[model samples]
Target: MKQLQAELHMAMLMITHDLGIVANMADEVVVMYHGRVMEAGSLDDIFRDPRHPYLRALMRAVPRFNMAPGERLTPIREARASTEHLISGAARPHVAHAHDGPLLTVRGLTKRFTTRRTSWFGAKPGGEVLAVDDVSLEVRRGECLGLVGESGCGKTTTAKMIMRAMRPDAGEIVFNEQGVPRDVLALEGDDLFAYRRKVQFVFQDPFSSLNPRMTAYDIISEPLVIHRIGDADERFARVKELMGLVGLDIRFLRRYPHSFSGGQRQRIGIARALALSPELLLCDEPVSALDVSVQAQVLNLLLDLQDALSLTYILISHNLAVVNYLADRIAVMCAGRIVEVASYDELFRNPVHPYTRALFAAVPDPDLDRKLDFAALMEGKASNPAAWPQPFCLDGSVKLPLLDVGDGHLVRASADADVSELRA
Candidate 1:
């Protein structure tokens, strides 16, 4: 695009939420919020010395490679859930203190699709699509774990299986329910209904996930109504409190989903998911679709809510930067299997697997002088399991285990691969 622009000598007006792209391509920058331009200046002037508080906050919220190991992002307007509205009755689950055990556990979880199989003259049957393959994961209590990968990498599929939104072809999902480990996959009837109240999902698309026919109030209170937990008056009060909790105004409760902006609609989704006060929140790409400034607000809101409520989140996203900002531990998936799992600092400090390194290489560096590696991206060999270098390589005859190199950091490699080789 830069080549074309230079060749044609044309002025390109590129509008996007990616600050890295803006830093790399733009000579001038314009910061806007709520249909108004807050500031406009040269790229260096705007980024290096921002005048507007909103712009400054937006930049602070973005995850940068140069940021310190355990630094937190500063959101524009921090919002926390109000726990004072907790109804002392059957509606609320018995709140328990977070223990050392995992809040959720998944083992050998696999899902496959075989409907696309076809055979000519019944000679041979097509193999099924292994959407998820022998995946195992553990979510520590009160901590955010990120499931990250490119689209079609089975990140969302794994989350769906964990939430029981879809059934897995094989494997087990276990939840530590009030200090008792329960097999989540075997749950049925009222047990399943009770489980639903314990785990809630916040979807990727705010617009599509919500029903246009329903108003914000109806959407937020739908869970409460379905469970038959609170009376009309109680539900109404809860809805109003939820609106305030998510930074939405009570006046907008009667408005339909179409009337709300992208961020507002997402707030409604978050509020709806929180209606049951679930201990686990499966947030699938919660902030990817929103604008940059709005993304900051939502990310901060999730952080604040987690701190206030002791919520455990399984945040799924393709953006490494977003995950970097929010996740305590990140699991990197490629094709259908997890390639790496490590602490936020360890993963960023040293990404061991080829697929993991490829993902890092693909991330658009915020540094204006550092250009993207189109050659590595175009080759795409690193992400292909069959083409991975050395002991990391996989083929039909070989399946490797995720061996821990050190300090709980796992990397999927062949049996012969040693820690020194991986570190090298």
Candidate 2:
């Protein structure tokens, strides 16, 4: 889309969550929040030195590979220290201590969809599409595991299976609750209901995820009402507590979702998710729809809630920067399978897979000193699995496996690839 705009000599008004796209493609940038322009300036001026607080927060929220280890992102609204009390009684049992192994383990998960093809004259059966193919990964207790890939890469599909919103054709989803492994797929009735209480999801779009007719209080309290966790009085208290926890004014509880901004709506969603105090939070591109400034506030709220609640997160997003900001480890998916899994720093510093390298190359560096590699990008061979060099390439007949490089880092490559030779 960007290239076509440039080639035609057309003025492009691009709207995107990707700061990389903005940095690389935009000559002038306008930052907006709640349908109002917060700041406007040249690309260099906006990125190099942001003047507005919202703009500054937006810049800080973006995860740069060059950041020092342990650098913390500054949220727009800094959470209050006293908000910890909101989560005191709401936390689920057996989540306080760090487990010896993974909190949730998915093994050989596979999901295929068969579509029916329809023509003008007639309809016929379509071939099966493998949405998620033999994918396996683990999410440790009290840590955020990022699942990243382009659209149609199966990140969201995998998350849905984990949430049990959709059942997989094959594989095991093991939930290790205090060393007791419960098979998620095998659960029924009360067991399934209990599992749902232990896990909750925050959706991608705040606007659509919420009900327009429902007030903020009704939306957040609906979960508690469904679960029958507490009486009306207790649920009302919980709702107010949740509002405070997410940095919202309690007075707005009676206001409908349409009255709130995108960020505020998302906060209401987060509060709703926390009503049951689930141990595992599956956030599907939670901040992708918000403005850059609002994105920081939501991201920071998630971090603060994670710490206060001891929550484990499986965050699925296409934005590597957002993943880098929150994820302790990241799994890069391609063609319905994970191609690489590594710690944030390790993956950024030494991306081994061709696709992983391609993704890193695509991220635009905000620094004035560092420019994008147009030559490398123009090649465009890295994303094509067929174009990868030997040991990384997989012909139709080759049996490729996810091999361990070292230090817990894993990469999918040909079975014949020398593991030691591939170590960075």
Candidate 3:
């Protein structure tokens, strides 16, 4: 902050998991889970008047420092079937003012991969792994929608599909191009290539994303050369400008990726993402790979870039706190499906999804008096991941219904009434 104040400049992208930093620096926040936005709003609205179930659970999960010594704090709930109603809202026109029109839209999207196995004859695959199953979402211009979930929940795969790095099995990806709705999945040849220029990605691992053999200037300029957007002189000039835009020293342009720290490399990644002046940027765990302190800087950079360039973003990560700070809306995902979606404040105050609550509970809160032993909690429950047929429904017989209780809040139902309710 001191350096930025002294330079009178800021970053282009910032990704992180900390809330304190966000409270101090962020103008908006979007909470996500499993490649979906669950809640979103301005910073004050989210923290002070959270309206979503997932957001509420997350806030409760924040460890505090002033709890009476040994009193047991409330535990977060787990995802289940009975909470299905929580996923439904009162079906109103999507007239959210914070953001307008879908910048990126996914309808009836599904991605299934056939497993490759050895056979007597050169045989085709038998079964498939359904990574993403019938997911639909809309992100408007200049809006930040966060996707949050646990590990191995297909969050990264969803991002890849949006970036066209992975193909979807079935669905429509609609985006506005020159004032017309275009099917992103069908784009090819020059159209596809051009779309790539308009929609860019900031990878999770900044160090790996940046080429070791290339100088920072080369890295930033490479996009211009490939897109054939500007002449050599213009590209060089743009490269220096990008360096400055991302809060990096122009002198560092000649330096290699390995020459800089993790946070600096991420800045380079941001500069490269901006080379095309993209309308949308897909962030895949952008801050997970950086140090805690460094994460804040990168996150701030992203926010600054969004404001300066009018960039819309789809932020993917498993960190609820981070999502709460960056997203305008959030979607909670579990087992390849979105269990709930709501504005940031709504979701934080009253999350309906059991899975969402469990996720929040998993977060260690110092303020609360709670035990931290998962094995003990699951003594009667199955301990092995594979042993459990499903992450949400541990027992095969359990079925959940999505219900909208009120104010756009949805919850999954469980057989046991206790299961349907969040653990206190």
Candidate 4:
């Protein structure tokens, strides 16, 4: 299109929600919200001199390669969830579980696929494949742990095991509730029900995650109905409260999922996830399928909800930018194993793991002068751990372990691997 426009001397009006594409390809931009055009100008004028507050908010929300330390994205607006029909102390202040140990812990977590059917899930075919290869991680209360990796890196598989949607072949998941530890894999009957009430999952595709036939009200209140938490009147009122909480209008409660926009549908899914008032949420690429602008809204909503409900989160995604924006700590997965774990600031500033550095290199920058380095990225050979150099290589004898170089930054490397070299 650019070539044609240059050769034929044509003017094109490009409509997109991807700010990166707009920055690279567009000569002019029109900022619109709620069916109204708020600003229109040249790309330079629009980006450099965003006069409208909405436009400024949108700019702030765009995922970027260069961000100052601890600089948070400013959401366009916040949706405050009311506590009218909620449980007692629903709106209490967030209490960090730092001193209480981890809220959830996974030890020796492993899952294998026997047949040739599931090889596409980051596994070599014609043999037993380890989809989740001896993974272990922890989540603390009121903190967001971002599980980030490339596609088919077992991020979702780990999340599924945590959610108990799929049975893991081996591993013990311990749920620590108020100083008491319960084996998650051995949960039965009422124990399972109790466990389910404490954890909920939000899926990637909002449309598929929701029942197309069910109305918004029914969808949001289904968990309540199933749990027998409240009567019809009480549930309806609760549904209304949840809808408002997610910034959805209660007037649309009678409408089906298809009638709502992508962002709205995701909000509905979030509201449904909150119906049971779960303590932890497993968000599997929740905003990946939405528009860029909408992604900002949903990310902000998640943060707002976390603060209001004191929620713990395991946000799974391939997008590092999203993870950087929301995560307190980040765990990097590569080819079904955790390669690194560290606070957001530490990981971004000084990535010790080879794969983590490669991931950062792969990220597309919106800066005009800073083009993507395809050569270095291809040479990184990030998919195959066996191809890595020296101590980072996973050859026959180079067993890797999570070694701390400095300040709780864990990187998987050979025991004898020089931590100083990796840190540098």
On TM-score, the leading prediction is 2
Instruction: List candidate 1 stretches off by more than 4 Å.
Output: 2-13, 27-46, 50-57, 76-100, 115-127, 369-378
lDDT of each: 0.84, 0.84, 0.68, 0.84
lDDT of 2 at 382: 64
lDDT of 4: 0.84
lDDT of 2 by residue, 1-424 (tens): 6678869989989887657668887899998878999889999998888898877776676666666777777666664423656544655434545446889999999999999999996889989888898899999998999998877889889999999999999999999867889999999999999999899999999999999999999999998988998898999988888888898989998999989999889989999998888889999999989876578788888888888888899998887878898899999997788899999989988888888877777667665555667666538776566777878886554547899999989999888788888875
**Candidate 3 lDDT, 9-38, residue by residue in tens:** 755234445454455455678877667988
* Clash pairs detected, candidate 1: none
Candidate 2 C-alpha error for residue 417, in Å? 1.1
The best-first sequence of candidates by TM-score reads 2, 1, 4, 3
Candidate 4 residue runs with Cα over 4 Å from true position:
1-16, 21-57, 68-98, 117-127, 396-398
**Every model's TM-score:** 0.88, 0.90, 0.68, 0.86
Candidate 3 colliding pairs, count: 82
